[model samples]
Target: MSTAVHTMNATALKGRARDLGRRVTVLMLLPSTLWFLLLLVTPLLIILVFSFGERSAVGGYAGGLTLANYLNLGSRAAAFSNTLLLAPMGTLVCLLAAYPLAYFLAVKVQRSRSLLLTLVIVPFWTSFLIRTYAWIFILSGKGLPAMLASLGLENVRLINTPSAVLIGIVYGYLPLMVFPIYVSLEKLDKRLLEASQDLGASAFEGFRRITLPLSAPGVITGVMLVFILLMGEFLIPAILGGGKVFFVGNALVDLFLQSRNWPFGSAVAMALVAIMLVVIGLYLKLVARHGGRPGEGAL
Candidate 1:
């Protein structure tokens, strides 16, 4: 009887505590909940309704529903192709460049890490648009080509080419690429690396086996962040590619702004959202399958 009484009292105490905790949590969450509902949720609901409606001849939404918009999805296949291709390429390039820089920053410049990091972020203080514009002068005929021409090179057009676009993508997204990998490598244990070397492993081998795997979470985050944003990229391609290299963002832009086809625009927007979902799903699957940590999947 005494044991049962104690058990009951313990259970009741836990229940009361949980109730109090719930009240506290609700009080804490109320502001954020209301903010999201007002800003995000409501806007999303409006967009969903707009997607189903027709394009007004003048340029906006009209009250009607039809599958014609979705049927036109195939029209932007080239744009989709460019996005799927360039996004991966851009992300891979960023990763290739960023990993070494991150490794150097994390392992080499211990005393100057904060200063170097500040330098990396200094560019971000300015608008990304302004920075991309700086590249224009650099790649223009009078900047790079001019120097090359003085050295007896033939005609060179770097300002409006695919290579220029790639360079722009690399420059714009570098800081984003740097920070995550830096954080991961900075937090990594140095002793494991020494242990590998002590076990007769080369510096390269130790890094390949240990440093890379340990920083896999950061790698995944940096790649995903770059890739997802790349998929929706417009300004870089437009400014650099000279309208030759179209992307989904360009297609959406043309549909909405130039053609005044809101229905088709909505369909394209929906398709973009769908593609993002698929990419995110595949990314999660890959992370889970590759023995990455739980926190990595969340990233």
Candidate 2:
């Protein structure tokens, strides 16, 4: 009877401890939960509400239920098309450029890996706006164009073009793409490659069969990261495209700040959010179909 009572008491104490732990966890999460609610969820809810409203005569939301704002999305079709086209294109370009660098960092460089990695991210130490502004100068008529002109390529217009925007996107987002793929490749089991080699597979064949499949998660992550940001990209296009190229983000800025079309802006934002969700869902489904996990990379 005494032993049974002791065991019961210990069980009760364990239950109380678990309860206390849960309470502590809840307490610890409370601030972040509140912050998420106040900052993210609240704004999203407000945007959703405002998306259904009307634009006031002067400006801003007029607080009425209407689908006119959504219906008017067709007007910005060009911006949407530009964003859709350039975002993917930029992501692909970044991927093509980043993969070899990532592979080199992960596989080839052994001693100065840290230094090289530092070099890769050194640009990030400066302000992003400043970096982008520098690109404006670099691509200007007096910059790369001038150099190219001196090299016999006369009248080369690099600035204020889609190519300039793409260059900016690749330059700005390359590190983001590289790091994920690098981490994936870095953590990969090298033994698999060696085994494939022993089994008479060529380097390319080994990469195709083993390395590529394993590194797929990182590729997906990098692609998603670059693509999503590119979709909402404004500053690069604004600075480099010189009012020639327009994206959904640029349109949003114009609506909110320039035109003060709050309702329409909200509608556009909501639509962007919906589109992102659909794209992400489709991407995840595609990855899953191909036996790839999107969240497999270390970083």
Candidate 3:
């Protein structure tokens, strides 16, 4: 009877302990939950509500139930098209440029790796706006064009052009692309490559079969990061293209700030959100097919 009583007491104590733990967890999560609701969820809800309304005669949202805002998305089709095209193109370019550099930092450099890595990110120490502004001078007629003219390639117009926007995109977002891939490659198991070599696989073959597959998660992450930001990009195009190139972000700015067309801006913002969700869904499916998770290796 004594032994049974002791076991029962211990079990009851354990149940109480679990209940206490659950309460503690809930308490810890309360602030963050409230913060998320207050900042992110609330604003998104407001935007969704406003998206269904109409623009007032003077400019802001006029509450009503209508689909006219969405129906009028055709007016800004050019901005959507430009954003869609450049975002992916810029991501691909950044990927192509970042991979080899990441590989070098991860695989080749040993003693000075930290220094080189710091050098890669050194540009981030300065203000982003300042850095972007510097490009204006560099690509202007008195900058690269002047140097090129000296070399017999005169009349090279880079500023206020799509090429200038692409260059700015690559320069600005390269670090975001590089760090993810570098981390992925850095953590890779080098012994796998040696084993493949011992098993009579050539370097390229080993890379194709082993290294590429393992590093896929990083590539996907980098692509997604760059692509998503590029989709909403405004400053680079605005500064580099000199307002000649328009993106969805630029359009949003114009609507909300300049035009004060709050309802239409809200509708556009909601559409952009939807498109991002679809793109992210497709990316997730691709990751699933390859049997890898973001920020984790296939192995």
Candidate 4:
């Protein structure tokens, strides 16, 4: 009888300890969970709710649900078109420029890798707005235009153009693209490359068969990061584009700050989020399809 009682007490103590551990785990996660809820989830919910509401006469959100805000997306068609075209193109240009730099740093440079990598990332130390503003002068009539004009080129205009905006996009996002691909390449198994070479594979063939396949994860990550940010880009366009070439980010800024159309801005914000979600979903599906079994192409 005493033994049975002792066993029951021991079991109860163990169960209580398990419950205490579970409580501690929840407590540890509570701060971040609450932070995400308050800052991210709550704002998103508010935006979604506001999207369905109407704009007040005084230029704020008004009560009552309606699809009028979404229905009015056509009003900003040019913004959408500009963003959709340039963001992807910008991302592509960044990728093309970054990949080779990343490869040279990761696979070629041994002694100066750290120095070269630092040089690549040094631009980020400056304020993004400052860097963008600098470009305005660099591309202005007293800058590249002036230099070109001296070479018998008259009336050269680079600032306030789509080309200048592309240059800004490429410069600003190149670091983000380079680091990911560099990390991917750095982690890649050199044994695979050596074996391919041993089997008489040329450098190009080896890269195509091994290097490119293994580096795909980095490429995808860089693309997603750059593309998503570019979708919401305004500063570069504002400075370099001089408000001539507008993007969705510029549109959102004008709607919220200039026009003070809260409901319309919310609707545009929701659409941007939805489009990004759809794109990321499609990307995941494509990754899954070409994932080609475990331990295959993955770095």
TM-score for each prediction? 0.90, 0.91, 0.92, 0.89
lDDT, candidate 4, 127-214, per-residue tens: 9999999998899989999999999999988999889999999999999999989998999888988988888989898887788888
* Error at 214, model 4, angstroms: 1.9
- Model 1 clashing residue pairs (backbone): none
Whole-structure CA lDDT of model 2: 0.91
**lDDT (10s digit) by residue, model 3, range 1-299:** 99999999999999999999999999999999999999999999999999999889999988999999999999999889888888889999999999999999999999999999999999999998999999999999999999999999979999998899999999999999999999888987899889889989899977877777777778888999999999999999999989898999999999999999999999999999999999889878977886554324322
Report the lDDT tens digits of candidate 2 across residue range 90-166: 99999999999999999999999999999999999999889999998899988999999999999889899999999
Q: What order do candidates take by TM-score, descending?
A: 3, 2, 1, 4
Q: Alpha-carbon error at 15 in model 4, in Å?
A: 7.9
In candidate 2, stretches whose alpha carbon ends up further than 4 angstroms from where it belongs are 1-14, 150-152, 293-299
Q: Where in model 4 is the C-alpha error above 4 Å?
A: 1-24, 149-156, 291-299
**Candidate 4 structure, TM-score to reference:** 0.89
Error of 3 at 140 (Å): 1.7
lDDT of each: 0.85, 0.91, 0.91, 0.90
List runs of model 1 lying over 4 Å from the truth: 1-3, 291-299
Residue 54 miss distance in model 2 (angstroms): 1.7
- In angstroms, give how far residue 185 of model 2 lies from its true place: 1.5
Q: Which digits, one per residue and each the tens of the lDDT, describe model 1 over residues 187-275? A: 98898878778888898887777888888888888988998898889988888777888889988899889988777787888888888
